[model samples]
Target: VFALVFAVSCENSNVKEEPKKEEFRPLIVRKDGQYIEYYPGHKQIKMKGREDADGNRAGIWKLFSQDGVELSITVYTKGKKDGHIVVRYPNGMPNYVGEYVMDERVGEWKFYAETGELLETIVYDEPTKENK
Candidate 1:
């Protein structure tokens, strides 16, 4: 009976516990016309952006990685992605730079290596009817 109880306790101890879920609080409104979001426990800034009076995303929006590094910067117009969109590596180096016109990718999109070297440039063509 002693051996059986010890084995049961050992089995329970070996079971992995589920990770606790992190709860995200609401965006803190800033007087500068931007909204800021924070991480659950640390309360570190996760994102900062502005929205139109209609609650649509407008102007430049920046999203951060969990480590608090800027992950991407997207330009929005009236709720659609427009103008330049820049995504960065965790180290804050530009990973990709592309342009969007009225929500569709236009012109050349440049991709970079993690070391900040330009890898390739992909030119986007107008969407054909079949491709659309």
Candidate 2:
């Protein structure tokens, strides 16, 4: 009957709509080799990660700038950074090279001059200590 059909449609309409899922955020390559989202993005941005068959980040990741420049190339192992991580200047010269442990600077770091010369070396024996 029309009444039965109307009642059924009304009940269906009363069903709650599913909540929208949160957008995928970019993974922050931590020194512990874990990929966690450290920041949020507004648009659909491409991301890269070293993933195992289980789809967890297990190695290096290279994140690109929205303009397609290599923004940062980071290392990871079992989701932790354990090796050289390099970031470049817009012109592609070395911006930073250093070691990390659990996302903290824990070793020697060298900076290069814009002219491509070694600028300085900083040795970190402790997170709060620096020897230049």
Candidate 3:
């Protein structure tokens, strides 16, 4: 988990604020550790993940709604999505679950209904004769 430390400042807000101009949102700032993004004008974590020293995504990243419901989860390797990802409905039901290899979807992917019934299955990568 990323410990909130520094206050992020918007890169575009370096100039003096003009009364007529719209305010800019803060930019994400990090220092070779977990990254946590807060909701605009709020303190709740909108997204959180860890990154390598060079800024490459290193592990699982999770996104949440403003009220703290998990929206989706994805695993990354060197900034590329390389594992399972599950996206959920607003009510927190799993909408779809699939796997990724090197940022590409692979194997069987399943979609479900809000009632928790399987709706469909799609094979992203068919088995080859050698693998069969």
Candidate 4:
């Protein structure tokens, strides 16, 4: 049959498959030296961060909105979130400022309105420290 003939010809010719111009890529993937990643089905960047050779997140990472606006900035130490953190509203104004101690929120955390007005303040008890 024609199908059998075509299969035999392809095997003997060693024809390679052609690749498409636009290949599909995942929105989020963990790979060494990958510093930028997009959200699902979005063209704009969703997060920006760097990974060590061991595939651990290091240093600072930025999260973005679908509109490509920065929504949060978090610091990482040896793959753990630590240090200061900031989250913003859709308007790009800061929504909150807080600190992370060894991946846990601690100390005073201040929240703000979209208009840069302070809404509330919260103090998280340090989990590592005994409550007085």
Q: Decide which is better by TM-score, 2 or 4.
A: 4
TM-score of structure candidate 4: 0.67
What overall lDDT goes with each candidate model?
Answer: 0.84, 0.67, 0.81, 0.84
RMSD of each: 9.6, 8.9, 14.9, 8.4
Ranking by lDDT: 4, 1, 3, 2
Q: 21-121 in candidate 3: lDDT tens per residue?
A: 65675646465598888887755789889998788887999999998999999999998888899999878999999888877778888999987789999
Write down the TM-score of every candidate: 0.67, 0.50, 0.70, 0.67
**Model 1 clash number:** 0
lDDT of 4 by residue, 10-86 (tens): 89899777886876887776656667888777579899898877777788899999998899999888787788999
Order of candidate numbers by TM-score, starting with the best? 3, 4, 1, 2
- Give me the candidate number with maximum lDDT: 4
Winner of 2 and 3 under TM-score: 3
Worst 10 residues of 1 by lDDT: 123-132
State residue 13's C-alpha deviation in candidate 4, in Å.
Answer: 33
Count backbone clashes in candidate 4. 0
Model 2 scores worst on lDDT over the 10 consecutive residues at 30-39
- Quantify how close model 1 is to the true structure by its C-alpha RMSD in Å: 9.6
What lDDT tens digits, residue by residue, belong to model 1 across residues 41-97? 555788888988877789999999888888999999888888899999999999999
lDDT: worst 10-residue window of model 3:
1-10
